[model samples]
Target: MRLTPDEGDLTARAFARLDARLTRDTGRPVALALSGGGDSIALLRLATEWARARGRSVLALTVDHGLNPESGGWTAFAAEAARAAGADWCGLSWDGDKPQTGLTAAARAARHGLIAQAAREAGARVVLFAQTADDIAEADLMRSEGSTLGRVREWSPSPAWPQGRGLMLLRPLLGERRAVLRDWLAGQGADWIEDPANVDPKFGRSRARQALAGAAPPAPEEARALAGGRPTMDGEAMVNVRRDIGARALAAALVCVGGGATPPRGARLQALTARLRAGENFAATLCGARIEAAGDAVRVMREAGDLGRRGTAPQVLTPGVEAVWDGRFTFRAEHPGWSVEAARGRLASLSDADRTEINRLPAATRGAWPVLIRDGALAPVLAGEGVERRALVAERLRLALDETTHEDDLISATR
Candidate 1:
């Protein structure tokens, strides 16, 4: 694990490249998730130095999962390290009833959720993670062993969106090795905490690491070309093009419209794409989305049944706080005391014009549209003449599609 002077020089160059890419993608005021581990500590130092040189700011966030008694001390140490690097620091905790089973998965989700929330509150649009080459190799091994884990890309859209509104996740250190990073830290006379979970054989990741000993690190993946603008596809034209593009684009559309966390299964998606390519006209449902093919066009929308099953009860909207209703639309009110509920059953009360506008949307998705209530009367918030709000929703949907499309394209290219 020892690094020569040349390796150290290469690591520095890699850091510089990452800094430039991050600065170009996300401007001032970046956020870093610091865990008091060697990888994250190295990232904190590198990001702080880069931000200082560019006259920008960095927000260092540490999440205390509270699973271990020593987590509090780890957070304090992380905060101190951030301060030593001349960066602003914040600590968040995952406080709630701990699950009896699947503790690791639950904690990981909580950690990401808390980090995204904190970054949004701090007005940061991008958060950096410290996952390294070693982590990627281990993840690949886990997947080969039928773990069902997904690949971690270098640039990914935040999984916890709306709560993480306008946020992107960056793993700049994915190209660097863990040993090199720790060696770099040692050379700088810096210290980091060693979490016992890393070696607690009960964890699959720990077992993977031990199994990876003496194995050559996997070759670094070439950075994928992300679309600079929003992705658009004509369903009719897509079927005539590459099957990969058609399938990937279709998956992205379904996930975006359905507001699902992950895309549908690969085999099912591919089969659907094949059917569409054969010019079949039919309707079906998958991943909370209703897919309809008519004439030469295919359309996808949120499934009404799924919405009814999972929709949240009416909640009062507070001024300056945004809420995601029905997991499809993000609602924020400038005025207070407004309650948001599904537009279902209340559409009958609207004017003919409003009703027509509501009906223009896909039949399967009309039930999930957000409606405002005040004084016990329903009001059309997103229907008819509310062009600005409609445009905002469209923009968010486009962004989501862009992210999913980018990841899909990357995976296809790599395969």
Candidate 2:
């Protein structure tokens, strides 16, 4: 259904505010994760019009989780809706056997990965999601019932690991209520799917949704606030500690420097944050990141023992295939090499300069750093042997320090 004049104007203003939030990528398309549900259907309608008005285009992506027999029908419906809305569409599928446990969280992660990969390939720096204020309420309720789901925000970097790198999620509808959107869709004569899973009591979200069926969402939590100068990264993937850093920001630094998928949570993370905030001189480890504080300055790096305990070992570098080791370094090879392994036990064989550099890092950090193989001998990575390798410090640090971690105000950056 075409938007009424008021609806069109509302969408333009809402999206225009978001578009101004980030650097525009000039000519790249914006992507929407279209699930054929009420929220996404409304989003598809609004986005197509919003994009067209600004001379931009929209790509609607649907991920077929393959859990329901009706999933195919859902995907097809999504395609048709996108077409009707004047947006291009693509369908992705989760093709493997479903795990018996943790299915919901797993499916969500898979969906995030698929959408993030597709968005990047389409040259989008941001992917639009249709989460509304109801989602925030549900999350709060679920957490109260002991769920582990992270709190949803109006905007965040995508949650999928490396796949979600370089992309941000735009939830322009976060301030909108689910019921209001559904009511508007009905008035427009637009239809959407009501997935059976939503009402299934087996799921925490479903239970929460049922409990609050008609209850107005409580005031949304204040968006996460970030303050102070950003943390610095030394050559060794160390985040130089600073006073007055937020716990969330400090958690982000630990996760990045430690090469972990997510930041540590609960009491330990809070304790660490407290220490740094006081500018105390202490050494501690949380997640895989080890901290060395000297009162005047602090350094955070990967704990090599953590890597070994986690069974990090050598692996062959496959030509043309991107390889990630310790989640800290990524390597691609177009020619022969022995393997990518830790610098421990093999530091003596490296060139003098390479050895010196490696040794300069804190002793606990050097072992987890990557060292390449040349002619079956452990060696520092050579410059011209058809290999490409980089420490992922800059990219990870940038994400951790992204100032908009808590603000959603609907402004978006161009890619």
Candidate 3:
């Protein structure tokens, strides 16, 4: 269904609608990931209106991935569009020369990398993408080959930098039809440059875009409904989680397993067997540490990080490291090599309920406790007195393991 005109004043109104949907859960500044495309231009025109009305700022960003010679020109056009909209704007470039096996994936990686970095520099809270419902529909169809489970995420933060931490990488137009955006832009007499690569069959998203061109748009409410429920914690709680564990740590708990070494090729799948053994929503893909069900087993693989952060630094798996940011806290094994610290924490003894509650804590009341972890285990016992007594019993055993544990550590040794 086409979005109603009254629902939004201009294309920026569309952006306003989207921002409202996304920020309903996260109250932060919205950074538009602009590319001078029709959809993005439409959003820019409308976003500025919305931002002005609400007394907020809209950061216009364009990522120039030098895959095509035209990318430079596109970036310039995007800058002009941002200026016309009166938004604070920045343009960033990416050299696509770094050899990558997959062109589409690599370009996407590069694009997101530039935008995420720009958002960081601007200190913006959320990065908004002009992804339409058509994209969602294409992604929905692609789910057959693990595309559905792979691409469709309720929420995805920029893994490139923690700066985009808790910043929702949102598809504000996920429920809107592309034609509506096109029509809206046409109504405004706004012209946007089209990327020729979009027609190239080599790019997966291009293929999806082509398929979506011939399809109908989904209901905006339907698309919004897909995002799931409100978070248990507030902004502060989220900030704490990002601070203590870093976003990757909690992401690891949800997607990765404890292992000293990288798994062979798709080790993520193998670890996923544990999840599949328990039954979960993951699908088959070697995207990162997260694995999906394929046949009787799962595929295991290293998880992907933000392009800017990837291939530059070694992963840290330090135990007992805490990241405190924006009033929220998180604890995790920071050293990526081998962790012995997660074993030392007394918080591991807490009942699952207490752990869940702690993890669900709001950002406002994080206090000094800050959800501590060491190596790879929770340390509620050491952090506070509210921990379950049963956890204290396990604390003694964990402490002994921390003391006497070695490379050849045995579970039976503690017992």
Model 3 earns a TM-score of: 0.56
For model 3, the local distance difference test gives 0.48
TM-score of each: 0.84, 0.87, 0.56
Looking at candidate 1, what is the lDDT of residue 145?
A: 80
User: For candidate 3, lDDT tens digit of each residue in 1-415?
Assistant: 3546633444554654555444332234568989888888877877777777666777898887777778888888888889888888888877536665766656666777678767755656556677767766776665544541234332344434233333445565665677877876776678998888778877666776777777775544222221112112122211111111222222332322211111122344345434554555454433223333444433332222211223322223344543321111233443443321121133457667666664453221222222333344433333432221111112211221122222122222112
Candidate 2 residue runs with Cα over 4 Å from true position: 1-9, 22-25, 218-229, 275-282, 313-323, 332-339, 380-386, 404-415
Give the range where candidate 2 is weakest over 10 consecutive residues by summed lDDT.
406-415
Write down the lDDT that model 1 would get.
0.69
Residue-wise C-alpha lDDT for candidate 2, range 1-415, written one tens digit per residue: 6755655455655676466543432476788999999999988888787777767788999999999999999999999999999999999999889999999988998999999889978987778899888998999899887777777666677777677666788788877778767866887799899999999999889999999998888654455457645778787477786767777778778888887667777778778778777778888888788988886777888888787777756788877887777767778889766578777767677788787777788888888778787667645553436778777655766655555552232233212
User: lDDT: which candidate is best?
Assistant: 2
Ranking by TM-score: 2, 1, 3
Query: Each model's C-alpha lDDT?
Result: 0.69, 0.77, 0.48
Over 4 Å off in model 1, which ranges?
1-6, 24-27, 220-248, 265-280, 378-415
For residue 310, model 2's alpha carbon misses the true position, in angstroms, by 3.3
Tens-digit per-residue lDDT, 1-415, candidate 1: 5569745675576566556445533444688999999999998988888777766688999999988899999999999999999999999989989999988878877888889888877867678899888888898998888675656767666766446545667787877788888888988899999999999899999999999976767755554543322335432111112222355456656766666666664568878877777777888888777777776556676677776786567877666666666555555667665777777767777677767877877776777666677645555554322111221233344444443333222222111
